[model samples]
Target: QQPVQSPQAVILREGEDAVINCSSSKALYSVHWYRQKHGEAPVFLMILLKGGEQKGHDKISASFNEKKQQSSLYLTASQLSYSGTYFCGTDAYSGAGSYQLTFGKGTKLSVIP
Candidate 1:
């Protein structure tokens, strides 16, 4: 099953810090992180494997706990461009290319200067 994300919305001023968490009931093969600007498609942020391996774009960082089947994204010293809705996608192992992802409802983050 997909993970549930907390805090449906958040408001922050520039340079503030925030944390978003994602957790699943089922075992996860991988957890993918993404951020969507108001009018833009979701952009990949990071991917964390069951073995604790991580990969993704620069400027975004995340951590995954295999045993807990959970992940958290850390946003530090926020920027104006960081304002957006964050989503965590969970992928289960179904063999080979059969893996699929389920996204959380999302956490809306707004940043003000």
Candidate 2:
């Protein structure tokens, strides 16, 4: 099932911080974060496994809480380049070596001067 992303949209000034949350009722095997600029394909940002450790790169970081079936993306000291639509794709194991990925509607993030 598709996850639900909170805030749906966000506006921040450069150097500001923002948080986006994703939640799903179904069990999750992993949560994948991606950023897609206008007219550009989504770009992989990070992935947090169900039992794996959190991940971070540059000003972006993410955490997964398997028990809660939720994930949160942290953008610290946000930059102009961070402006994009953030998508959280959730992967669920369906047994028999099958997995399904469902993406959230997306959270639009805009950075101001």
Candidate 3:
């Protein structure tokens, strides 16, 4: 099943901070984070594996709690460039090498300069 993201929208001024969370009902093989700017395709942010490995863009960071089936994205000192919609995609391991991902509804963030 797809994960659920919290706080549909968030507003922040430059240099501020915010957090977007995602939770799923089923165990996941990996959790992927992506950000989409208005009128643009979603860009990869980060990925957290079930085994606790992490990978992705340099500026973005996220943490996953395997036992809780949840993940959180933290934005520090937010900037206008950070304005966008964030989504979390959960990849379920079906033990058949056919894992697939489901994305959350998304969290919209607006940052003002």
TM-scores of the candidates in the order shown: 0.90, 0.96, 0.91
Total colliding residue pairs, candidate 1: 0
TM-score of 3: 0.91
Model 2 per-residue lDDT tens digits across residues 22-108: 999998999999999999999999999998458998889999999999999999999999999999999998789999889999999
* lDDT against true structure, model 3: 0.88
Candidate lDDT values, in order: 0.88, 0.95, 0.88
lDDT score of residue 108 within candidate 2: 100
Question: In model 1, where do residues sit more than 4 Å from their true spots?
Answer: 53-59, 95-97
Q: How do these models rank on TM-score, best leading?
A: 2, 3, 1
Please name the candidate that would achieve the greatest TM-score relative to the true structure: 2
- Top of the candidates by lDDT: 2
lDDT of 1: 0.88
Clashes of 2: 0
Error of 3 at 8 (Å): 0.7
Q: What residue pairs are clashing in model 3?
A: none
